[model samples]
Target: MKFITLSNGVKMPILGYGTFTMSNDETERCVTEAIQVGYRLIDTAQAYRNEEGVGNAIVKCGVSREELFITTKIWVENAGYEKAKRSLEESLKKLQTEYIDLVLIHQAFNDYYGTWKALEEAYKSGKVRAIGVSNFYPDRFMDLVTFSEINPMINQLETHVFQQHKNDKKFLEKYGTKLEAWAPFARGSHGIFENEVLMQIAKQHNKTIGQVALRFLIQNGIIAIPKSVHKNRMEENLNIFDFSLSNENIKKIEELDLGENVFMDHENAEDIERFFKMFKIGNK
Candidate 1:
């Protein structure tokens, strides 16, 4: 697997496995298959309620803890310094790890500065090797990075072929934060699977549309975590390193960008309201 060095000098895998909607049982099964397929980076979150499943898989995967790069996010309910710090410890216990390879605030809302402080403390104390934020658009990202003691090593975003986040990438580059893509396949939204351009590219490269999509993200220096429950799909996603995309191919994919998000938008008022309501209801 290839890696990108973060601003703080930690190397992160260019590709990973995401446990977004998986239950504890499903996470364990899929993560086990994923690890067997040679995935070293495994991303989970407090909201996912499957950290224990990931932990189970970790113990059974026959790989040393040091060989895996485990990541989990702080949920909205765990938003302040005391809460976030306490949550991190709980995550450590559920993940069955003495230390986390990386940790991030799950969203831009809910006292993220306080959450970041907790992450910074974890980093300083060696409980976490790297720290970052997820779903933070440029404005909030800038605010946090500008005032925070430690700049985020990464900013995970809803990036895909349709929602390319090109400008965001350039903006984050200025601050030395790497852009990581969740839903790199657009979760099959925006007709991403059936898109003619991706299909044609896949045919040319003798790869699947999913492979081409993931390749596009990684080629542009974005870290991709493509989730799948099937072992075959897991293996296919991990097999993109053998071939490279040509410049012409890259341009065609670039033109497919719509410059809009296919999923939730952080800047939208309704979306922001939904987030507030959802987290207020409760968090796992």
Candidate 2:
């Protein structure tokens, strides 16, 4: 239940429930269970295609709208000012909310500057509380921060124990931007679940490897949105507040950083081109 104040002075939960791959039915059920488990932040994106399901759960859960921190992203296809603005309204309709706690550019590709302008306008109009970008590396992130009229308040990226984004964290700090982690568990890749170091740490703390991984990120001031469909796993992900990892344990986990992305790199030319193509077709 810890929170981080964004550059714009908005308090965001340090931990949240992400609806990335959760199906429509599963998203409704999982998000409802997550709220009952004490999660107030819910992160969804236009590309995820489950905004309605999330909205349904929010309404059915009977939680007041003001108590929940809801976030959604503008997809790449809606990159122009007009399109982005229209998409925001559409998202509002789908989410069944009058105002969004946060809205982010889902990816760095396409006319993000145009999309940013829409976000700025929306923020000023009180339709969005905060605005940001996702999957933007240090270079692009800095570029946007430098030229934009309103600085980005958050930068969501691929962050986990194996790829801590230490250098990016420093750059974001310089720009007064907060770091939010998408794949906080590394999507179970690179043997993250079975790593000896994490296993030993988990054994000592009597916690799961996933708990150790999430605790490591949150202790370092990064917001983590670990998604799970199962109610038990969702509750487990929210149970990292009791214990603290010692400095020695933190340093040991720091040594595990590989300094590279375990997921797709947005900087690669082909990858970027393909991403834009998908947006052009509005498939995602």
Candidate 3:
């Protein structure tokens, strides 16, 4: 596995295990297999409600707590200085760890500034190794990073073959923030698994399209966390380190970018309304 040093000097694994929309049982099983297959970076979020499972896996993975990088997010409900700090303590208990490797604001909603302040405090106290934001677009991202006492170490987004944050990447690099991809396969919702171009590239390298997709992001210095319940597929997601994509291969994949988010547009008023409805916080 490769590593990227965040602006804050934290070494984060370039590829990790993501636990999103997973049941507690599923998280326990899959995270266990993922660790056994050589994954040291484990990502879970308070919204995912599976941190307990992740914590359980950590205790049973036979890997020392110091060797693993555990990450979780502060959800919208817990989006302020006091609440964020309190929530992280709850997360640490659920995750069964004294300190988390990384902690991120799950979204741009609620009192994210307050949430960031809490994260900063956590950082100062040595409870979190690094701090960041997820799903922050270019404008919102710049605003937060500008006034932040400590610039965000990373920004997690929905980056994949179709919706490759081309402009976002440019600015993140300019501001010295690392970009992490949440759904590296577009949740397999974008025909990405069998896209003609990606399939061709995969055949040439004898790699699965999933591996090719993840490799492209990792080679570009983006941290990618591809999730799967199947042990074999989990193993496949971690096996992309052996092959390299040539410049031409990288160019071909780059052209596949849709230039827009393949998932919901966080900037759209209508989309935001519907998306937030999925969660029942903040008087919704």
Candidate 4:
């Protein structure tokens, strides 16, 4: 379990278990298994609607609160100062913790500026250890960083071998912000599991394609949260810390970058509107 020190000097695990599409029951079981497998960080969100399960797993795992890094986000619907603050308190109750390590705005849309004000206040009050934003592009990210009282400690985006986010990483580095990857495996799209280059590299290291994909991101200094319901897959994702990829192998993986998003493109206005519409109906 390697750690990445944030701009505020908080140490976060380089790898974490993400609860994206997992059901509440599955999240509880898998999070418990992940903690048993030596995972100290767990990522969840208000939209995930499984924070209670994560909190239950933490309590049942018997790991001290200090040894764990728990993160949750404020959904777009809760993106105002009052709502965000209330939401954070609700999250704390659901998580069964007094304080949170990190709390992020789930998306850049809606009233994110107001949401950020609440987060800034929470950080100052010692309720949240660190504050950040997820799914923010460079333009919106810069706007927040320049205008806010506290610079964002992290900006999590969709990143993987295919969507490498080279330009975004450079921009984030300028503000002393760390980059976290949401879909580290690109959700196994575009035949990622069958990529010849990655498979060949896995053979050389005697590892699986998934392991190779995770290692590639970690080697590039990106924080990744890979999700899996299976305990065996959870263990496999955690086994990436033992090996190193050579410069040649790293270059080969770089060539695998397609420079485009494999999933939803937030840049499109229609896509953005459609996303918000789903949030309105609570479909996401």
RMSD of each: 1.7, 1.8, 0.9, 1.7
Q: Tens digits of per-residue lDDT for model 2 on 122-211?
A: 999999999998999877887888899998899999999988999899888888888999999999999999999999999999999999
Q: Which candidate wins on lDDT?
A: 1
The candidate, 1 or 2, that scores higher on TM-score is 1
Candidate number achieving the greatest TM-score relative to the actual structure: 3
Cα lDDT tens digits, model 1, 1-284, are 99999998888899999999999999999999999989999999999999999999999999999889999999988999999999999999999999999999998877888999989999999999999999998789989998999999999999999989999999999988899999998898988889999899999989999999999999999999999999999999999998899999999999999888776777788977776776563442
Candidate 2 stretches greater than 4 Å from native: 273-284
| lDDT computed for candidate 1 | 0.92
Q: What are the lDDT figures for the candidates, one per model?
A: 0.92, 0.91, 0.91, 0.91
TM-score of candidate 2 against the unseen true structure: 0.96
Quote model 1's TM-score: 0.97
Candidate 4 lDDT, tens digit per residue, 55-146? 99998998899999999999988888999999999999999999999999988877889999999999999999999999998789988988
Look at candidate 2 and tell me the lDDT of residue 106. Answer: 90
* Model 4, global lDDT: 0.91
Question: Which 10 consecutive residues of model 4 have the lowest summed lDDT?
Answer: 275-284
Which residue pairs of candidate 1 clash?
none
Per-residue lDDT of candidate 3, residues 1-284 (tens digit):
88999988888899999998899988999899999999999989999999999999999999999989998999999998999989999999999999999999999988999999999999999999999999999788888988989888889999988888877888888888889998899998878887999999999999999999999999998999998888999899999999999999999999998877866798799888877787866683
